[model samples]
Target: MAISKHIIITSLFISLLLLHPLVQAIDQEMTSNNRGGSSFAPKMNCGVACEARCRLSSRQNLCKRACGTCCSRCNCVPPGTSGNQELCPCYYTMTTHGGRRKCP
Candidate 1:
């Protein structure tokens, strides 16, 4: 009886150890799916939106470049030429290396 009890406990402990990685992989997959599977994220027209947002900037080329980068990453562009950042949280929170707002 003592030897059988030891075997049962050892088997259960080994099984749990083996199952840990499989459980972690399933959790990671669920997390990725919940974030909108990359292949299924809605595509946005970055060109038109960037153009519209950067239209009034004195540095048109720079504005377009920055806006395009932000839109591509966030898949969004806040409407209007300026000051409506509340519309897109992802776009609004991006920052440059200098710690200034990066999104146009």
Candidate 2:
């Protein structure tokens, strides 16, 4: 009887130990879902957007730099080579200290 009690207790202890990680994983998943899926920011392909916007610029390097900055901040870039700022209001509204449009 003594040995049987020890076996039962050990079995329960091992089962609980094995289940601990599973419980934690489920809890983490629930928390992440509650907070809107994953905690990481949504990936944006800035290279493609920058290329499209900056291709027409005489200073291609500077165009890319400015476009990248706006893209990172707004998480968006207006479509086309130029003149579609209406598509992205945030990108459109951003301006330089000199009162010029900051985004490409």
**Model-by-model lDDT, in order?**
0.92, 0.88
Which ranges in model 2 have alpha carbons more than 4 Å from their true place? 1-41
Backbone clashes for every candidate come to 0, 0
Pairs clashing within candidate 2: none
Candidate that scores best on lDDT = 1
Point to the candidate with the largest TM-score.
1
Clashing pairs in 1: none
Summed over model 2, clashes come to 0
* Per-residue error (Å), model 2, residue 20: 29
Tens-place lDDT per residue, model 2, 1-104, is 99999999999999999999999999998888768623455757888889989998999999999999999888889888888889878899999999999898
lDDT of 2: 0.88
- What would the TM-scores of all predictions be? 0.64, 0.59
